[model samples]
Structures are given as C-alpha cells and as structure tokens.
Target: MKIRIMIVDDQALMRDGLSSILQLKEELEVVATASNGQDAFEKAREFTPDIILMDIRMPGSSGVEGTRLIHRANLPVKVLMLTTFKDTELILEALEEGASGYLLKDMATDTIVQAIKTVYSGGVVLPEDLTAQLFLDKRKTPHSDLEPVGQPVDRSLLTDREWGVLSELGKGLNNREIAEALYITEGTVKNHVSNIISKLEVRDRTQAAIYAVRHGISTTYDF
Candidate 1:
C-alpha cells in the first residue's frame, strides 16, 4: 500500500516542490497540502494521512504546537518536521511534542522521502549533526530533581536483565544491534524490548527512550 502524505508549509514553492518530488515515488502519495498549522490540523482530521511533512515556523501557530495538537487527537499520522532552522531547542521541543522525525529544508528530495518512510515504519529520524546537538544540549542542561508527572514508575517492574536491554535501547540500538552487543539472540532482545515497553507504559521505543531519560534511568548510555 502506498503511504499517504500531507505537506504543511506556508511557502507555496516549498509545498509545491515537496509535492512534486513525492509524486514521483511509487510508494508514496501526496494526499493534501496546507498553508498553516490550523489548516493542517483540520485537513489532518479530515484526510488522516499516514505521514505529515510539517514546517516549523508558521504565522498562526508554530509547528511544535500543531504537532502537540495532532498527538493529542490520537491520529495515526506521524509528523516529520521540515524546516530551515537548526535550533537545537526547537528540534527538541518538536520531538517532545511528538514529532516522529526532523529534516532540513535544504535536504535533497530523496532524503526527505526516505525520512517519511523511516518515520512511518516507526523509526526516529534526525540528521547526525542535529542528533549530536540534541545530546549535547541534554548534557549541558543541569539535572533537575523534579519528577515527571504521570503514574509513578515501579523500579521493581523490570528485571536487571530487562534494565540492561533498555539501556541499550536508550542508546539507539536496534534489536539486532542490541543482540550483537550483548551476545544474546535477536528474539531475546525483542522479548526484552516488549517487556520494557509494557512496564514503562509507552507505546513505542522512542517513548520508552524518552521515559528512561526523563527518569534518569538510562542516562549513562550515549545515543
């Protein structure tokens, strides 16, 4: 099945360029385009595309706010932020708001297409430089003692082996990589990941990683 896509950018040229490029890909279809965050939200509710290419800066509402709204709506759409800004804070904000990935505005068309597919497949995508910047920002920020607001985390819920598996996961290791690194079977790594997700009350690996970071449970490992 072709992956349905939506473009949300204020610039007409950008929207047109992205649409033209995506139209050439047999595996993707550009279902709709919107000029602003509000329009994108409405169209997202109506069209419900598999992925959305969102621009970070817009007149009415910023892409970060829009991403938050889409996430709250609980739609199946994954949002890939496309923007010219390289601000680390902005990128982290978007990710926290539930963006699946981020891409630079000047990136090649093929890269953007690949990012859409990667995010749709439940993988997080970010430029290596941006990813480094994100980690650097995290490290530079002083650790806070405040706890995150949610169900209290149960440390006893995860076994020591499971915690080790999640430590690898928080470092952005895939199941195969985790297995190879830990000298374990891929099936075993998968089982550990599943248990970790269930214990953490997160929907995906990305969320699980975020949870680990927020709680300081997996901060020693680098991504």
Candidate 2:
C-alpha cells in the first residue's frame, strides 16, 4: 500500500520541492500540504496521512506544539521534523512530544523519503551525529541520584525479559534494532516496549528513555 504523506512548511518552495520528491516514489503519496502548524493540524484530521513532514519554526503555532497536539490526538500519523535548526532542546522537545523521526532540512531527498518509510514501519530515525550527541550528553549527566537502590525494577508488570527490553529501549534503540541486538522477534520487542511504557507511566519512547535515564534503569552505553 502507498504511504500517505503530508508536508507542513511555511515556505511554499520547500513544500513543493518535498512534494515533488516524494511523488517520484511509487509507494509514497503526498495527500496534503500546509503552511503552518494550525493548517497542518486541520489537514491531519482531514487527510489522516500516515506520516507528516513538519517544519519546526512556523508563523503561528510552532511545529513542536503541533507535534504535541497531533500526538495527543493519537491519530496514527507519525511526525518527522524537518528543519534548519539543530537546536538540541528543540530536537529533544519534539521527540518528547512524540516525533517519530527527525531530519535536517538540507538532508538529501532520498534520506527524507527513507526516514518517512522507516518511521511508518514503526521505527525511529535520528541523524547519526544527533544520536551521538544525545548519547554523549546523556553520559555526562551523573546518574548517582537516579539509580534504584533496593531493586532493579518492579517485575510484577514487567518480567525480567521485559525489563531487559525496556533497558535496551532506554538506550535509544528502536523496535527492530532492539530486536536484532537482543536476538528476539520484533513483535516481542514491541510488546515489551508497550508493557514498559504502561508500567513506567510514560507517554512515548522518548519520555520513557528520559525516565530510564533519570531513574538509572539504563546506562548510556548499554545500547
């Protein structure tokens, strides 16, 4: 099946360029285009695209806020943030708000398309450098206060295997990659991820990762 896509950017030229590039692929379709976050939100509900290419900075509501709104709606529309700024805060905020992927505006068209597909396939895509930076920053923060003293984690809701899966997830590996590293099936990895999310009381993987880091459940180099 063709993957439905929506482009949301203030620049008409950027939107047109992206739309044209995506339209070239046989399995991708551009369902709608929006000028800003608000318009994106409206079109999202109307078109119900499988993926949304969002620009971080917009005239009205920023893409971060828009991502948060769309995520809260639970619309199955994965968000891929495309922007010029590589501001760590913005990137982390978008991820925390439930962005499935992130790419620089200057990325090659092919990479953008691949990112969309990856996210649609229930995976995450982060720029290599950005991923490295995240790990380095996470490592620098001391976890002395966050470590659980008595027990590793409650296994009532999570089995030992599930906690192991969550620990890997805390290291920023997506489902497929996590499965590969753990020598398990993707379906099993996903189930464990879901259980971990519910047990941790987190909204998304990003938040769960943060929780794991803060609680010392996972180490930076574990992944």
Candidate 3:
C-alpha cells in the first residue's frame, strides 16, 4: 500500500521539490499540498492523509500551531516536521504538539524518504546534528528542571541497567541495535524498553528518548 502524504510549506519550490522526490518511491503518494498552516489544517481535515510534511515557519499560521490543532482534534495523521530552522524551543513545541519526527531541509532526499517511512511505521526520526546540539546545550548549561512538556520522570528512579537501555534509546537505537551494543538479547532489550516507558510515564520509545535527553539521563558514552 502506498503511504499517503501531505506537503505543507509556504514556498512553492519547496513543496514542489519534495513532492517530485517523494513521487519517485513506489510506496509513497502525495495526497495534498498546502501553503500555510491554516490551509494545511483545512486540507488535512478533508483529505486525512497518513502523514504531513510540515514546515516550521509559515506566513498565515505556523506548523507548530497546525500540529497542535491536528493533535487536539484527534486526527490519525502523523506529522513529520521538515524545516531549515533548528531553534530548540520550536522543535520542542512541535514534539509537544504531537509531531512524529523532525528532519532538517538540508537532509538528502533519500534520507527524507526513509524518515517518512520510519515515522509512518511508528518510529521517531531526529536529526543527528540536533542530538549533538542537545548534548552540547546540556553540557554548557545543565538545567536541572529541563523536562519534556509532561509529568517529569525522576532519573534517579531508573536502575543502572535501565539507564543503559535509555542511553541506547537516546542514540535512537532499535531493539536489535541496543541488544548488540549492550551484549544482551533482543527480548531482554524489549523488556527493558517496556519497563523504561512505564517508569518514565511516556507513551512510546520516542517519548522516552525525548525524556532521557531532557532529563540528562542519556550518557555521552552511549553516543
């Protein structure tokens, strides 16, 4: 089945270029396009595409507002933020507004396609550069109160083994990768992931990973 996609950007060139590239994949389909968040919201309600490629900055309305609206409306559409700006505040807002992933505009077309597919399959896609930036920010000014917009989890509660699991998650490792890295079985990794999610009070591995980063629970050695 071809994955339905909606492209939202203020620039015609960007929307067109993304559409053209996405059309090359046999498993992808462009269902709709919008110039701003308001238009995107209207079209999204009408078309109900599986995914939306949203630009952070727009004229009429911002992608963050649109994502919040969509999320509040309980739509099934997953949002993948595609933008040039990497402002940490905006990125966090998008995630809090229910974006499935974030990718920069400078990423290769092939990488964007893969990111879409990954987000479609219920995975998170954060740029490696952004991860590095978060780590650097933590080192420069360690905010003890930094937490994702939700009930914060106490990192002190996590067992040492669970910390290892979450560190791998911060690195964006899947169960297999985590198992190999930690010299554990995949089943063990899965169990640890589940426990981590429960302890963190997050919905999925993606949210847990975000929490790990925000709480400084992720170790530099893991990366």
Which candidate's lDDT is highest?
3
lDDT values for all models: 0.76, 0.76, 0.79
Q: What's the candidate order when arranged by decreasing TM-score?
A: 3, 2, 1
What would the per-residue lDDT of candidate 2 be over residues 34-148, giving only the tens digit for each residue?
9988788888999999999999988888899889889888877889998764455676678888987688889888888888877787666665445555545544557623233
Evaluated at residue 128, the lDDT of candidate 3 is: 50
TM-score of each: 0.73, 0.76, 0.78
Off by over 4 Å in 3: 134-156, 159-161, 173-194, 215-223
The digit string of per-residue lDDT tens for model 1 on 1-223 reads: 9999999999999899889989999999999999887788889999989999999988898788789889888978889888765465666688778887688889888888877877776556655445544555555667823344222456587887887787666554667777988899989988998998998787777666655544445544322
Clashing pairs in 2: none
Candidate rank order under lDDT: 3, 2, 1
Count of clashing pairs, candidate 2? 0
Q: What is candidate 3's local distance difference test score?
A: 0.79
* Over 4 Å off, model 2: 132-177, 198-201, 209-223
State, as a TM-score between 0 and 1, how close model 2 is to the true structure: 0.76
